[model samples]
Target: MRTSDAQTLIVEKNPNPVADSERDALLLNPVFGRVFTDHMVTIEYSRERGWQNGKVRPHAALQLDLATLVLHYAQEIFEGMKAYRLPEGGSTLFRPGANARRFRNSAERLAMAPLPEELFIESVRALVRIDQKWIPGGDGAALYIRPFMIATEAVLGMKPSAEYLYCVVACPVGSYFKVGSPSVTLWISDQYTRAAPGGTGDAKCGGNYAASLAAQAEATREGCDQVVFLDAVERRWVEELGGMNVFFVFDDGSIQTPPLTGTILPGITRDSLIVLARDMGLAVREEPYAIDQWQEDALSGRLREAFACGTAAVVTSIGNVKGRQYNFTVGDGGAGPVTGRLKDALLDIQNGRVEDRHGWLDRL
Candidate 1:
């Protein structure tokens, strides 16, 4: 609950864990979020008991009442991160402190009790350390860590639930989409918008993502990899992909992304790339990028490349854009030199192949 109370974690090993060979088979080519480890961490909170019963226990199903608040009201928040298997034997987490802070911010936005930053990070560490054997290696594989909080009070009221449950789970994962293909095609959504000016767009809550499913399904029907949403008011400016932030590379060796105006989610990977791009001597700016401008620039050779960034996808090139009025390709419809270099740099630092100039990795 607090920094001083961080050490109250009680760990219970699983009695019947998955066999090593079966885990190895799953790790060979694990699908994202499908294969989980043996253990999980959970913490409970309430008004009377601020935070209690912190434990790293065997993974199992939760016994939630039918009238649970989160089931109907959706008072929940979550954070996504990864634990990379270091080349030198151990494993390391990437920017976990940032994730912890973001989790707190998301909790505040959702009106849920925010867990202490130390406790959040410690929960992740406890689970990943106990399930370290589940972390995959090579081919951009790692252990995907999901930390989430949900309202558990059995009430049917419209107010925030008094009781809450925070849990951490880990899964071995490969590339988010697939291997080999490092780029994606996007379908611009003119009918649906992700968030409005004064909405929960900035929060990492389930409702926001649930709202994007229809658009994503539309993208699938249109034969595209992902959907790109526009501003809710004008439907002109580019906001972001369904789950990732968009970046544009100009012919003048500059980078621009949609500014965080409380509509676009402030992604941790996006922030890290802004710093990394600037450190590489590239001019970076957070500006409002319009869809028509993007089309014109790409067709006129001014927009050299575009890519999306997030915790899951890491960095993926945007090969082409498909809209109702116009369609265009970005720089030969493949990964550009800048995107490749940035991706490699980020991966090198994450996988322990190069020096961590920014100290982003927390080794376990």
Candidate 2:
């Protein structure tokens, strides 16, 4: 990778690489998050030096202080994206610049120093370029790239920390929530909310997800795959799943997802899905999808399909939604035709099986 505008830090390769047999076996199942690539990218940010000391180092334990601001106040943000092995033996990152922009936005939201777009993209490219052999090539597998920033300053005050750390880590993996392919169940929780109306929901911070873990546990207990959260205040309108955004497909060939109303994560996959849907000649709507409408339409088959989109899960078919005492099964309580078609099309583009008509793929 070559970049004239920024300085790059290079690290020596890992001497103790994964054994050939062990790596082959891991690629067989390639359970998600089970293993990580040999190396990662890191860059530190401070008020004095800005972004400095960029490096592609071996993946190891970070010596973080116990009194770090991230531990005390949770000033952190993250972005999830992927690298794919192209058909011609090379690799690419899908919408990596978009993720870089989102990473900066999340940093701004948390009052942390934002890394330059070029620097962020360069660091990610450096990692993926060197780790190309580690990128999984099987069906429904991908190189999951997690780029995150954390408040590392060991201050006790409630304000944002002065020192921060940014890093990009990659993992070769399988499906995130495997109930089979893209079909799964979810429970809408009217009890605990995901994001408040004016809260930090739009930012990809750790606390937002940390707050949803309990609800997710509850959803699992109720025989659901994931938990969907309503608005935090009045708890009326639909928001999203803990880690994914929700989408509704109508019988009239229309698609709808909740608007980015400052209380929900504006997912990169959600944006790409909307663009792809429009390319497929579907009338896509970005309006507030209420909870009651889901129940009413699913009962009559007007809501033909329901799905959630994210970097990890790409496109997941939501089978049913159970809100405490109320339960509604969508589209025969399984993956609908529309959902399957969209998921297949999206995956084809991601995996280089279909033409990236929307210019979504970034070739390495």
Off by over 4 Å in 1: 1-3
lDDT of 1 by residue, 26-123 (tens): 99999999878999999999988798889999999899999999999999999999999988899999999999999999999899998999899889
TM-score of each: 0.98, 0.96
Each candidate's number of clashing pairs is 0, 0
Worst 10 residues of 1 by lDDT: 1-10
RMSD of each: 1.0, 2.0
Q: For candidate 2, write residues 163-224 as lDDT tens digits.
A: 98889888898888764644788888878988786788999989899999999999999988
* C-alpha lDDT score of every prediction, in listed order: 0.93, 0.85
Model 1 TM-score on a 0 to 1 scale: 0.98
Cα RMSD (Å) between model 2 and the true structure? 2.0
In candidate 2 the C-alpha lDDT for residue 41 amounts to: 86
